[model samples]
Target: MTTSEHGAVPGLFTLVLHTHLPWLAHHGRWPVGEEWLYQSWSASYLPLVRVLRALAAENRTHLLTLGITPVVAAQLDDPYCLQGMHHWLANWQLRALEAATTRTASGPSPASAPEALRRFGSREHAEAERELVEFDAYWRHGASPVLRELIDGEVIELLGGPLAHPFQPLLHPRLREFALREGLADAGARFAHTPRGIWAPECAYAPGMETDYAAAGVGHFMVDGPSLHGDTALGRPVADSDVIAFGRDLQVSYRVWSPKSGYPGHPAYRDFHTYDHATGLKPARVTGRQVPSADKAPYDPDRADAAIDGHVADFVDTVRKRMRAESERIGRPAHVVAAFDTELFGHWWYEGPEWLARVLRALPAAGVRVGTLSDAVRGGYLGGRVDLPPSSWGSGKDWQVWAGERVADLVQLNNEVVDTALTTVDKALARAAAVGAPTPRNPVADQILRETLLTVSSDWPFMISKDSAADYARYRAHLHAHATREIAAAAAAGRQEQARRLAEGWNRADGLFGALDARRLPVA
Candidate 1:
């Protein structure tokens, strides 16, 4: 085995985190919508960014690849969301304080108010207070400047995707191409750095997308290990295109967290499903997978911290073994790319950010080379060319999760809405051209396109399929579809005044991509 001066292993390891969420602002709040945004911001985005910045302070470079979809980026930079998130953090602190103060008037009964819960509340209150202060000081301006700083500092590589997180394989080729270009342009405008790689929403791929990616100047993307027919140790060129497709190593990636098992399932970690209903706080530990939330053990930070250290060491060992075995099998240095949703870090797995920081720091000491996906490509870790099949990192490793029998209706709805919106915009453009009017500046057509794109988000179908929040997902999909239909109807009827009114109304709710113009809609 080859070794560095420190006698570390000789292999490449890349960590990729895909960040995305559909248009949620002005949609709903309590159970879903903007709440999802704020929770992720507080739990995942803020902490993960802090971790990277800390590493950067020590001159860590090419740490990992971060894919922030255009839609999510738009929300992060939005003034409305900025204000909403700040208020939400403040409220979170208040709720924690209330939880801490809850007590029985009759006596100091343990059942009335548990000591563990009070302690948890105190911890949460302090954390929220710190986060609130940080938000006002750094994030009041929006997430773009902060993210751009990381990119400029060489701490992370930004991976840009299409405007909305649509399943590209199922989308019309014209719309897919249009979304890809517009999405990259949006990222460029925000970060002043256009990304050459993307996370390929859901890691979904179909034939001929390589050509489209090449045309759009995309250099690399990701797919599941099965997409490469189980050989995913290195990046592979796809279908005669120079654009590289990096397959996520399920063995190593799942070692951190997976549906069946992972570090998060340990008994010491915080229980994700369980919560104290009265205070909206999770005070339970994952005592057992089969145990109900109420029956789980009270959470203890000391136990969780111990578990984090154990998992981090186990993860480092897992990576070392995989790298050595793969290198020997291939008779050269091999790369292992472990990709996960950014939300998994803190939102789903409370110890995720800490685990991430520890793993990134520990790997190098163990002789493993860690870098972003781009670094692997640049370092010549490209494997042989292979024809990738239609696949995703979802259940069944196929298109079933987003377009299966379970969500057939959503699939149909997406097709119908996209078709109607595109046709309406096309007809309006033709009429405007005939009448010597400005077609590109039509606000009604622009809103139609925006609402239509939002309707086609892959999150709706996945959510419905998983039954995590089926009702909310369905509501969001239909809500945007209704907006698209009404805007199109008004525009097609030549009711300019009515169309403008409807467009303005919808824009207040689903107005993410301010630069989204109907003129960018691809001709079909």
Candidate 2:
């Protein structure tokens, strides 16, 4: 209902990058949050940071629309995580060394194994090492300091969300309000910006969640285009909230993760599966042949460079065409926002950075304006009134992926734990509010709030669903359950001392979200 900066707005093309992972520093080693963090750091964060810096150096604006969940942000700042990530980076170099030596030994034409190993220790290699060290330092020293710089620099438009990535639709509706309000308050304090929008976990949307969003002071929210059911695109006000629903532009998003296909599956890219047991690298043909690691072709920068050009050009053409047609059909300027997880670039697809930089630059050259989601809402665009459906931007745009039979128990348990935690916190806060005018700040209430958010994290069930490290997932759920239990015991027994000690322990361990106070809930 309110457009804060309507005059200077450009037609919207939101490039949202959802960034998250479960608590992973002390978890198991592979296939879930820990590995996911390492893989994404190397493949996505490092390179994406490179791309952002490059674009900034050239003064290219509207560079990114990024989402960082609180739990993931917490890990990125943890000292333990910094050490683990550094070791992983060093080990990756060793892996390259092992792969090169084994491949050369089996080659028909001798490869330069010494040359490859030398490259690992060379100046270029040292430079890469230095870059990661600096990047990691930025995150560890205080992610908010660096992240705030990016936001204030106008290089990006930051998006905020619940403390943990929760599927709001299925969450107890009362807690949805609790989560949303606390998330924004925390992010605003850290980043020094009151975000006008939210990237709902999995882009999940339910019909009445808008009230919670409105209560939280979010202006615009996102959902997959299909989730609109039959609604309009620009965005629409939800009841009395003044919060608007901005649907994803499926025309553009489907290029990366669709029902049947995506460019990442192209044979030219490094295969995600079927890594060599001998060399610990993916060196075989992904589709047809049982090509051995030794026989597979080496990665040629030239081939990937050429592919990037073609893909970028194709994307630009596609976007330009879509914008023209959609504008004509709607009889207004169509805002096409294409969103994706930040990890997909460079992490899932090695050549993703090149593709992204090219696409971002190409959009403007082709007369298709690119922007962040908030930019669109600020531009005064409006949608026909309609309610969104219960949907997520998962494999099926439904909850099936996270709530299927395979992971039903985990999902069901998560809902129960989250609901219980919220209920306990609500009661505790109500008592706190009644007894005293309020302390300078309520750290106890904040700790309880922290426990509540950690328990509600979507990552646990998601990790279980992927079937990667179910044990770690189970362990984490139990860990959060313990925290939630601590809150319940403290509230009931009036053992505020025990609650304080446990809260301090979590503070010593994971202190990011432990700074919230329920008394600061926007004056209720």
State the lDDT of candidate 2 residue by residue for 19-105, as single tens digits: 877666655676555777777777787777778878888888777688887677767767777778888777766665565444333
- Find the candidate with the highest lDDT and give its number: 1
TM-score of each: 0.96, 0.84
- lDDT for each residue of candidate 1 in 1-524, tens digit (9 for 90 to 100): 22354377767998999999888888889788889999999999999988998999988889899999998899899999999999999999998897777663211222124676677788899999989988888899989999999999889999999988999999978788888999999999999999999999999998779999999999999999989986888899998989899999999998887788988899999888777767787778888888765467778899999999999889888999999899999988999988899999999999999999988898887889999888988899988888888888889999999999989999999999988988998998788778876655878888898888889999999999999899999998999999999988888888889989999998987788888877877776
Q: Candidate 1, 239: how far from true, in Å? A: 0.8
Task: In model 2, state the lDDT of residue 317.
Answer: 66
Clashing pairs for predicted structure model 2, backbone only? 43-346, 43-347, 235-383
